[model samples]
Target: MTEQQRKDYFDKVDKNINEFGYHLTNVFESKERPSFFYSTGIYKSFNLPEIFIPSLPHGLCCEIADNYVKAFKDKRVVPRNEKLQHLSGRFPIFLIDVPTSRLTDYVLSSVWYYKDGNYEYVQVIYPDTQGHFPNDAGYDYDQEILGEFRL
Candidate 1:
């Protein structure tokens, strides 16, 4: 999808999230079930990355990544045995908005394997903390907003 199209799609999700609190973020383009789809929790100037995580309950960052790998291996969006599929492999990608925030302790991790299943590539996108949350709470300053996109 083009940049504009991606922005538009994320905008739609943002609107839905605002109205419904949370929504299922799915990738209908994939032939097999999606291993993982981008999700976000928006509060004020922050847009936190999240996972839909059918097999596991809602969790914080990297908390449900193991479930993501199991789904990828089984080629199923919803794993059959929830109890067994409990381990988070390293994610494939990480995108952080770097220009605005003071860069520090940037780390990238990965796990590689070629298996005939699903989800070949994992995409990680992290926003620049400074760009997203420009001013700290209780600081009167000009309002600034970050670009809207899925991780």
Candidate 2:
């Protein structure tokens, strides 16, 4: 993307986020990654719960992530799974809007999770063209890794 296009895209993203009562918490950028990742949080006046998930092994983390994405794509609350509840407790849901021609209102319900106490990443649940969440069909799917950063 050209510099102008990049600016325009982020301008829209910022406007949409503000319209939705959210503000950017942090932005992750890396020379190694192809895309930029924006972390957001609800405004203070919104009175939303803040949820944090402790670091877990890769396999269990992926499982909870799959379920989390499914719940958001289906427009339902995240399921009350024992493991998820134990790890994350209760937290508010955040949204990241993606500009796509296929779906104007496309967005990802997102949260933060730690991986083995060494890495932290954002997990977002979004729908594909088939209207199905990824990793639901027994396919070995990889969640979109927004970026990797050094602390």
Candidate 3:
């Protein structure tokens, strides 16, 4: 995707977050990945898994979403649960559209765990073909964790 398209896509995502009453608390960007951390005013909001950080609820340090490199070799749509297996612990998960040049469309599901006072973010990229997570299909997935940092 062109630079303008990338900016436009993130703008839309920010707008959606505002519409939902959640606001971004921090943002991190690098050559290989970009991430957004968010929080809501509501009580008992989404939280990260305890295994990742036992002191906080999923919502307190929640990584609302992120984007990562698409590295699937097979090129097929993957089930949500299948993607979750690549994650370390249970927490709420949702898929979001991401801009990509490697595929026609990419859906990224994000979950977070707390580590070293920062959020260890995991994003499972579901491409139209050959998903980017470990699965029964036996495809080799080599991408590393996309982003991690404090909120």
Candidate 4:
């Protein structure tokens, strides 16, 4: 993208963040990894850690994320490091702290927009069909397939 195009892209992102509490970005899957979507501006606006979900269908991810932002705006923040059924979805969400080292790989746009990496983040971890989390015994699938949790 040209410099002008890049400027316009960031401008749009800024507008979205200004209008809404956070901005949602969807990254399609590639050969190396599965698809993912994440939020930006949550920390700047609400002082709440940003969130992301991976491997689920893109549309579903967006729906859940939008709902999450909705709840967030409603002053219903998600609790971290525990099983949660607060968001609108069948799968309970577990918020795991996203290490600062991994921030560049996941939330680069957010960091760029804020011009800093001092903010905190939490990955919205989802469980398998049996409701078993990554750390649980008899967990059904690999954690990375959904999303990585680095605490």
Best by TM-score: 4
Cα RMSD (angstroms) for every candidate in the order listed: 18.7, 14.1, 15.2, 2.9
Question: How would you encode candidate 3's per-residue C-alpha lDDT over 12-119 as one tens digit per residue?
Answer: 545644565223343344575443333321111223211111122335335322111111113323222333432223333222222222211111211211112322
Mark the 10 consecutive residues where model 2 has the least summed lDDT: 111-120
Global lDDT of each candidate: 0.32, 0.33, 0.30, 0.73
Kindly provide the TM-score of model 3 when superposed on the true structure, using C-alpha atoms. Answer: 0.22
By descending lDDT, how would the candidates be arranged? 4, 2, 1, 3
Ranked by lDDT, the better of candidates 2 and 3 is 2
- Tell me the lDDT of model 3 at 66: 19
Model 2 over residues 1-151: C-alpha lDDT tens digits? 7999867766665664467543332223347422222223332213332122222233443444334443443443333212233222232222222222211111222222111222122333333335333434642433452222111
Candidate 2 accuracy as TM-score: 0.26
Lowest lDDT sum, 10 consecutive residues, model 1, at 105-114
- Candidate 3 global lDDT: 0.30
Mind giving the per-residue lDDT tens digits that candidate 4 earns over 44-125? 8877777777777777777777766666655646566766686646777777777656757766678778785467677777
Which ranges in model 4 have alpha carbons more than 4 Å from their true place?
72-78, 145-151
Report clashes for each candidate as comma-separated counts. Answer: 9, 1, 10, 0
| Candidate 3 stretches greater than 4 Å from native | 1-21, 30-34, 42-129, 134-151
Clashing residue pairs, backbone N/CA/C < 3 A, model 2: 51-91
